[model samples]
Target chain A: MTTKIIYLDHAASTPLDPAVKKEMDAIKTYANPSALHQLGLEAKEILNNSRSKIAEILNCKPEEIIFTSGGTESINLAIKGIAQNKGHIITSKIEHPAVLETCKFLEKNGFSVTYLDVDKDGLVNPKDIEKAITKETILISIMYANNEIGTIQPVKEIAKIAKKHNIPFHTDACQAGFLDLNINADLITLNGSKIYGPKGIGILYKKKSIQLEPLMHGGGQEFHLRSGTENLTNIVGFAKALELAQKEDNNKIIKLRDYFIEKVQKEIPRTFINGHKKERLPNNANISFLDVEGESILLYLDHKGILVSTGSACSSEKLEISHVLDAIGIKHDAAHGSIRFSLGKSTTKEELDYVVKELKQIIQSLRMLSPIHLNKEEIRK
Target chain B: MKIIGYKQDKAWLYSNKVKEHFFNPKNIFKSDQELEDYKNNADGIGQVGSPACGDVMEMFIKVKDGKIKECRWRTFGCASAIASTSILSEMVIGKTLAEAKKITPKDIVKALGGLPARKIHCSILGDQALRKAIENYEGKK
Candidate 1:
């Protein structure tokens, strides 16, 4: 018999909500939203309704919302669209690869980017944004909440500063859907996959006045900001998911998260939580176990049918350490030992209890074979 | 302080053999207290890697009559590195000092079934530490 898997990696991507799936299944996938025929017009109306619903939740005009593939594309349009040529952009070191690599790609062009340092809690200072701004600085990009550590940034204050300087501001709120929306940003990115919506669907909300050159040069859709045929079914699913997410009491899920964190802190010795204690996402629990490599723990946990994730270093192409952990000043060696356990609304207390039991045993056994655990005096600093 | 350098394919991230070693690593020194005692009693010791690259291995051994009687290792690394060190410790014991000295990274890779291409360097860690311990033992003699 196959072991039942308990998924705890919701921050990476959440499962499709049954409500969303139902709504998506009902959508007719025949007519393109752009087609001028009777069915196409009907599709256009459906698409418009979905946009209005999402706009209502985000408190933005429906016309201002630009549909894109996902967080990465939204971010590319937000950053690269504004700073495509010869200017400076300011962003934090702890941003997702979508935002960071977009800035990096801009760096390859004529533009320059300043990667601001985050505090130990993975927060970007608003003053740093003000200090970094110059006459040439065009946009300031930061995330509403980090994906790996789940530390929420000071988006409101940073947006205020950016407004004071009249520089366009963008925040990738890919992982911040369950929380309140940060409405201060000129450009905001929201992903469907992270919020129980279908993958390959995302939103970019622009405040009408913000000018962004189109990334894709086709069909002149999305008011010339983003081109191509709109994905209506996934968009409807995305809207339904967001509507469902906003209606649910996230404090209940937060309670589950807190209980787990409390249990981990109380029972697990020589372990520490990575993100800010209070100012973090309700679902995130990034913890570091001293001397126990996270990948080994991940494999062992997988064997026991408990799913979790390490940083992108282990999961991605590069063998490097996690940029977020490194930015937060975690020692490289200790950073390799970090695990992110993101809870979901569907997560139950019994599942968490089982995880805690297995975790305690795993840590004990792994430490038994750990050389660093054995020679902590000389190796640990 | 890294890259004992062995060829491995990208597809094989971990083998069942590697998992067996990692889940129940052999001849581990257990705690820092035990490691301290093992260090004090060891006839030879070897060290490699640094915290910068997210891996470091330190090994200790006891040699009697030109043969390795005990082998123990401490490491800060990923799954493959930890498993490699554990397997190397078991392989070295009951072998002549000269034979232990001859164990290459490739031998460790072969024994572990196989490791990922990027993680093949981790096997080098075990081989280097063993080589270091054997050299230290010979140097003392």
Candidate 2:
């Protein structure tokens, strides 16, 4: 028999909302949106309505919204599409792999990139971005909220810096769709899966003044930026999900997130919370339990039906420490023990209490098997 | 052979035997006090790896009449590392030093039904600790 799953990995991906599913299941748009028939015109009208709804929420023109496959494609189009021959780009060290890897690909293609560092709390200094800009700098891409630590960046300040330098700015806001959407960025990326919508659909908002190179050449879709047959069903679900996500009672989720963080720290010894205390997202709680391997603890927790993510190398395919934890200056041993508990709207206090109790037992059992000796005095503090 | 039914198929990372040993390991010290007590009472003690490098194994044994009367271990590592050490302690408990030394990491992996390729390094650790504990026992005589 399968145990009841207490899902705490919302930052990874959230389950689709029932309303979104209902909306998608009701869709009858089967003909291609580009076809010249009455059915195609109906499909195009549905597509435009979804775009207008998203644009209204984001407070931008409807023409600014360009649909892509997902967050990765949107990010790639923003970074690579804006980039031309061998110029400098500015981004933070704590960006998601989509942005980081895209910049790395540009670097290999004879572009110079300045990866600005984050502080211990994983906050990037806007002044650092201003200083990194050069005459050849073409784009500056930063994340709105980090997926691992949930540390939100000062995107407005960074946007002002980019504007002063006459450089185009992009912010991957896939993790921040539940919150405010009025970000002052030239290019913004949002996805469906993170906001309780269907996967495989993403939105890229490009200001009308910016010139972008098309990544795909077929049918001249997505303003000729990303060419593909539109995923009409997913687009409708994405808009509905984004609307419902903003209407959620986020204060309730924040309270549970804080309760989980506080309970884990108080009950489990030698544990400390990662990321900033005040500037973090309402749904994320990253904690490092000293001296225990993250994957071992994860397996133990999984056996108890508590789902979470970890930064430990054993859990990663690369067998490499998390770049986010590494950028925040957490020691290797502490990084190896880190686990992320990202809460969702359905998370309740009793569920969190159960998780804290299970986590305490798991950490105690793992520590008994561990050979590393933690300083008792340091842990007490 | 299920890790979690939801997002990933982590069961593919290990065999059923490995998961069994990992969840409820064999021949492990019950608590910190018991481990401290055994450290003082064990006939030979061997430790391998460091916490900084992310895996460490500590093995303790009690020898009687040139055979291991008891074997117990502790480890700070991943699933394969802990399971390997737990099964290794059980494998060497009643064996003579020579016979125990003949047991290789391959043998441990085979006994556990096989670990992933990247995690094979985790299996090597238990064999190293067992050999070192045997060496420590022989060095005294």
Candidate 3:
């Protein structure tokens, strides 16, 4: 038999819920949502119902929700859709590459982008957003919660500021769970895979009156915002997934996550917790062990059948210093050694306890072999 | 043989051999306090890369009869870098300095059963640092 696995990287994506899977299997409507026949009507109904349910979750109108491929597509549509390759945009240094790279791409093509600085806790100050705005500024995009460090940004306050300045605001809520229960932004991006729903499905919540140019041009679907054949099965799965997600006992997940972080801090020496102590995602605990490269820890954890992420999924394989860690102003050692342990509803206390036990031993062993010893004077030179 | 299959482990960008050396790296200085013991006894020392750039490596050696008798290293890099350095330590033993000089990143990659395409840079670290230490030793001559 294969080794029993423990998954702790929910921020990248979540396991599909059996309930959602059964829902997907039960819905056998395969016609194009735009077709006018019976199968098409059934597919259209599924699409409408899913959109309505997700709109309810976001407390917005059904017309505001537009289906897309996933978080990256949602982000691209939101950023580029608004900019149309012109005007000023303001974003943070710690945003997902989807948003940062999209903004950078816009920059090279005759648009100005102001990458707002964040505090040491990886939080962009709302006041900083206000200062960066100018007459040429057309939109501001900030993430709801950081995918790597798990620092929840002040979305509503920033949104209020953007509203006062008459600039459209967008926030990538891929890491923000169902019920959103927290952030409120004009354009919010939601990913299906991050919520235990099927992959290749996501939504862009554009508040009524916010106009965005269509990223995909085709048969005038999705209110002309995103045009493509609807992914009815995943859409239906996402609706159920969101409903189940908001109903989950988040307190249990938070308790388990805190227990895990506390155990690591207590057992490991010289371990630094990245991100804000509070005001972070209840399911995330990102920590850095001095002298223990995160990739090494990740592989060792994998050896023990425990899974984790060194940083965001996009940058993990590149083995580069995390920009999120860098934006948090952590020292070079702490930044390079950072690892993220994201909890999900399935995480258990027993698993966390086992992780801490194994982690303590692994860190102790690796430190002995690492060159970053206690002799700091030599390194400083 | 499989490191990528637990929810999202396909991102495990490491070969099995690389995993082996990383989990159990070979000869290395245990700690700064212990390295104090070897402060004056080592023949040559070379340091490369830096923590600021996310990787740094240091190699300490003992030369005997024109051969590398002992090769101990310490590095703050990704798992691939650590594994490559560990394998380098094992490969340089009993080899003359010129033979050790002939060891390249391709040799390290071959010995480690091939690192991930992106991690090939890590293999570069140990060989470069070893060559630098040999140069440092030659300068003293």
Candidate 4:
């Protein structure tokens, strides 16, 4: 008999919700929203309604929202659109590749970018953002929460500074939407897949009067800013997923996540937690096991029908230490041993129990083979 | 069985033995003295591949009146590499230098029951180190 797989890598992506799937199925048959016909009007109405629902969840106006492909596109549009408008940009080093790479691109294009460093907890100090701001700074983009470590940033405080400086602020809120909507951002980007919505659909919340040059030029659909035919089905599904995820009382998930963390800490010796102790996302528990490679642990767990992620998915191809771990100053030994366990709305106590049991066995087996680990008795002698 | 290009079906599989040695390797040795004392005083002294390439091993030897006396090793590599070093140290502890010189990488691989194809190099490294240490002892004489 095949063993059931326990998925603990929800931060990577989530299974589509049944309600979200139903909404997408209903909207799939609609014609293009930009077409000038009765069917097109129906599609347009669905698209507009989804936008309004997303905006309401974000505590912003419907007109402030623009649908894009996903987190990457939303980040690109926000960063690049603002870079095209003015001089310099300010961002943090712990941002996702979408924001970091976009900032690099802007830098290459003669737009200066100041990459502020985060604390050991993977949080950028708002005062650092304020101190880095110059008269030439046109925009300040920091992530709402880190995708790897799940440390929530002080976006509201940073936004206040950006407001005082008359600098537009953007936040990649892809990892924060499932938790809270205390954004207070001039521009915010959120992805559907991160919140169990459809992939390829996201919302970029651009406050009214924030002028952004269009990334694409064509049909003038999204306020002549992002020109394209609307992805009605995925957008509808995204909105439904967002609304459902936000409406639920997530304290239970948080409690279960803490329980798992407690179990792991108690069972596994020398396991170090890798993010902000309390201010981290409720679903995230990133830890580093001394003297064991994360890939080896991940593969061994995979063999036992359990799934987990390393610090960064990007390093899976090259088998190098994660950049996020490096940015947060995790040394080579601890960095190589890091694992990220991100719980989801569907994660249950039974799954957590099974994971803890299997993890103890796997860690013991792996540690036995590691050359770096010596017993306390041996070390003392 | 030949160590190189040996398929799992054609050769005996020894993954379980390799894993056993990897997890519970016996005769682990450490030193603060010169390399020669550890080499001449132990049962066997085996130096394997370089550590820079992620492969390294050192096995110690002690001989008394032409009879092998003691053996210990230190290895820095993957699970199979370290296991091969430990198994080779065990295989050569009681053998004279002449007999130990005849021990090939295949013999070490066979002594460990068997090794995977990618791990054949580790056994080869162990064999080369043991022979080099034997050569070093002979030159002293």
The local distance difference test score of model 2 is 0.87
Task: State the lDDT of candidate 3 residue by residue for B1-141, as single tens digits.
Answer: 222323334555667787678867888766767677765677778888766555678888889999999988887777888899999999999999999999989999999999767778877889999998888888887
For model 4, how does the per-residue alpha-carbon lDDT over A33-76 read when each residue is reduced to its tens digit?
98779888888888889989988888888889999999999999
Could you give the TM-score of chain B for each candidate, in order? 0.87, 0.89, 0.87, 0.76
Could you estimate the TM-score for every candidate?
0.92, 0.95, 0.90, 0.77
Candidate 2 CAPRI assessment class? acceptable
DockQ score of the complex predicted as candidate 2: 0.42
**Reference contacts reproduced by model 1:** 0.38
Residue range A25-74, candidate 3, lDDT tens digits:
99987799899999888888888988899888778899999989999999
lDDT of 1 at A327: 92
Structure candidate 3, residue pairs in collision: B4-B9
- Write the number of the candidate with greater TM-score, choosing between 2 and 3: 2
Q: A321, model 3: CA deviation in Å? A: 1.2
Superpose all Cα atoms of candidate 2 onto the true structure and report the RMSD in Å to 1 decimal.
Answer: 3.2
Error of 1 at A67 (Å): 0.9
Q: What is the DockQ of candidate 3?
A: 0.35
How do these models rank on lDDT, best leading? 2, 1, 3, 4
Question: Between the candidate structures 1 and 3, which one is better when assessed by DockQ?
Answer: 3
Instruction: Report lDDT (CA) for all predictions.
Output: 0.85, 0.87, 0.83, 0.76
10 residues in a row with least lDDT, candidate 2 chain B: B1-10
TM-score of 4: 0.77
Give the residue spans of candidate 1 off by over 4 A: A1-3, A312-319, A373-381, B1-13, B29-41
TM-score of chain A of 1: 0.95
